[model samples]
Target: MGGLSSEENASSKSTSILLQIVEHSDGSVSRPFVPISAPSDDRPDATVLSKDVPLNPTHNTWLRIYRPSVLPLATKLPVVIYFHGGGFVVFSAASTFYHGLCEAMTGAISALVVSLEYRLAPEHRLPAAYEDAVETVLWIQSQARDPAAGEPWLVRHGDFSRCFLMGSSSGANMAYHAGLLATALELLPLQLLGLILHQPYFGGVERTPSEIRSEDDPILPLQANDTLWRLALPKGAERDHEFCNPVVAVPPELRHLPRCLVKGCEGDPLVDRQREFVRMLEREGASVVARVDQGGFHSVELLDPIRADSLFSEVRRFICNDL
Candidate 1:
């Protein structure tokens, strides 16, 4: 949650040094800023009991399930399939920051949360993550058909009929693409209720006003954003690739998507793109609710407890009541 140090801040104004990368001899790179895997918490007093399982063992893709510690008396809870944000390169389902965020979401929304750990970039780029997302949904659909076929927690407590796709940052991008696939293919019996995109990561060749102004942003500097996208998209693809910029080619499924919740922040460099996305969805006659906060940067919910709680409250309303 800490911002740039005084010295780093001074240096950042002159030259952005965020996300210092370390290249490995194995043709992979690393960002040494955030450590990985904080371990799943299943403490008795915890609001939710979490466990990880392989969604597709063959691909090293896995997911973490967050079930409410205290189940309701009669009703099965809504199912929220989530993707973590790491610019499509870093982080995992078990990462400390995302685990806490999902746990909070499970409690606040009173739903079953499944956080996906898709393969990262500089290794398994673009369509790989998008494919994993669709696979995740298919796996859930299989589990719903026969409770004994998959994870017992979901089989017992989840309401596949009231499902949602939610994510933050780059993860939100994955959710959007996957949502389109799900709607187009009509992955039935596993009803998709809505989409929740929190500061969706999108880019284009043109420099957005927010992006230009956030040159020295401590969390995500301009250089880091460009580098991540370069490593994520196809070998020669530009920022305007359909995967990076949703506005490039609006899919027919765009209007058919379920209700959507698009949340953006004024302080985020990608805020302009988020706003543009909302406008597009509205023009398509899609049911969309746009919330643009006057302050806060990208992934502010991750750093601020109050903001996180407020976000969860909004999500709870969106899922449990608003929709």
Candidate 2:
């Protein structure tokens, strides 16, 4: 009753409201895929131009890049390497929902957006997505080193020194882990300024109060969340694995990492865990900014345009001034 008002959920509900989990004999899982959005760069009316590039040719992973149509002569734009959320088991950079998201982000934040299409589970699992995330950053670094070899958008106007990682839901989880890995490696010339985690998906064997209150909610029910973790985490791993629960998993080296902005919604089942995560970040001596919406559900920005714009505004503030 306390989470996701009925009206809010109703606006997004459909025949596929509940994610029907199909567990495979090989320990993999499947779900109904949403409609995909293709990349575009020739639209004269559009403010942002988007195109896809191969990130890992061997693994079939690619990244979708979004940049403003008009170039800025005075200053290079900050780069935002983004990851889309689908509980690590669904969605892609090409998802219709995320395409619009990156486009809006590109225009509003005035930053070049690169949305990674990483390998998902139960096909890839855990560190696989995390591995791809770090690799994507490395690819960007390589591009920065050789402008001719990189996409003109990145080389011409993108600011490599002010790079940021932003992701939603499970993608946010990947951003956190990958940020840690990238920082530890000391990848030179390409600096990480900050991290943006939107309603991050974190869990544990024990339920938090928010999870309990929204166990039956249509949008991301507790059982659905557990199934996702089961299919995403390594086999035999519980929700307590470092990948699922960050409050207990932050590394000692995280003390000097880039600033982090963690945003959540009160109607989300994961809000309590996100709050605890923010506290943990503070306790660990990390610079953190936390914003919680008064009323909304998980990934509410994706469904509500006004909420999405509000989020974009906050992200703009964070990228332009806060960070």
Candidate 3:
């Protein structure tokens, strides 16, 4: 809850210099650059099946599935359906860095990981992304029930009985809403475990202390966030509208839906809001685990490869423990 002071800010400035040096070092060049390839229907290991499958008729909505190689030998694993962060305006599942992260998560948790590719904004507009997310989950559930009906992807890797919803940033927003909708309609299968939100963008009526303090964050500027929310929500509606704010959107009846693992970054502007939402969830007696990392920025977990391993480790542990 403490804000970074002037002295801490100065230290961060110095750290940035060292970061630049390390980024440019020869050792960094030797690291493999992950390529963002289209989700394919292929098995990397005898027991593991990985594939890209379309979720919608338009074929615009799709997801990449990764099932662990040791699945059959191990206990029935939990499934994590993940949505990537992109400010709801940019990025795709083909992003090499994120794809690699998903690949790593599959190995880390030994669970099935589905990286959802939902529609982006300014083109698809508000609600389209959320609708796509809801449909994708439903489609995934159906596929799990009858693998034959789905593409070769699910037939090879999906285990629907242990399913959870997860996302980062705007994608996190979608996952949050999808969970709410599932609870509201009682449509979600009993296997739907919980939710994991990483630096979710939940716009509110007022700025939190972190938002005001980190208005000038190097990675995610507050103004940019304001802009993204303005474009992502329904036209002319308040940013804190029930749909935009999960804390408000979640109904009392849906309170018992599932456990949630909320991750936040100390240096991110949305940290305070994220914390506030977690507090609200806990107050409602929901099973919640909030992990706030120090000296981290928005999307830092994905942007920094050096940190990705640690981040993935924590996430994998959460998934395994909660499942």
Best by lDDT: 2
Stretches off by above 4 angstroms in model 3 are 1-36, 40-49, 69-71, 152-156, 186-190, 248-250
Minimal lDDT window, size 10, model 2: 9-18
CA lDDT scores, all candidates in order:
0.85, 0.86, 0.70
If both were scored by TM-score, which would come out higher, candidate 1 or candidate 2?
Answer: 2
The per-residue C-alpha lDDT of model 3 at residue 218 equals 70
Model 1, residue 136: what's the lDDT? Answer: 90
* Candidate 1 TM-score to native: 0.92
The CA-based lDDT of model 3 is what? Answer: 0.70
Q: Can you write out model 2's per-residue Cα lDDT over 1-323, one digit (the tens) per residue?
A: 23444354445432334356678887766678678988888778878999998988988999999999987889999999999998899888998989988988789889999999999898898899999999999999988888888888889998999899999999999999998888677666788889999999999877788886765666787667777888899989988899998877678767867999999999998999999999999999899999999989988888999999989998888887554
Q: Least accurate stretch of 10 residues (summed lDDT) in model 3? A: 14-23
Local accuracy of candidate 3 as per-residue lDDT tens digits, 1-323:
34344454444422221122111332121112335765534545434446777788584788787776555653455778888876676667767767777877778767778888888765666688878878877777776656666655454655566678888887787788788777765443436778888888886766678776754567665555555666566778876787667676657755766878888878887887798789888888888888888877888877787667776777777766743
Candidate 3 TM-score to native = 0.80
Off by over 4 Å in 1: 1-18, 24-27, 36-42, 321-323
**TM-scores of the models, in the order given:** 0.92, 0.93, 0.80
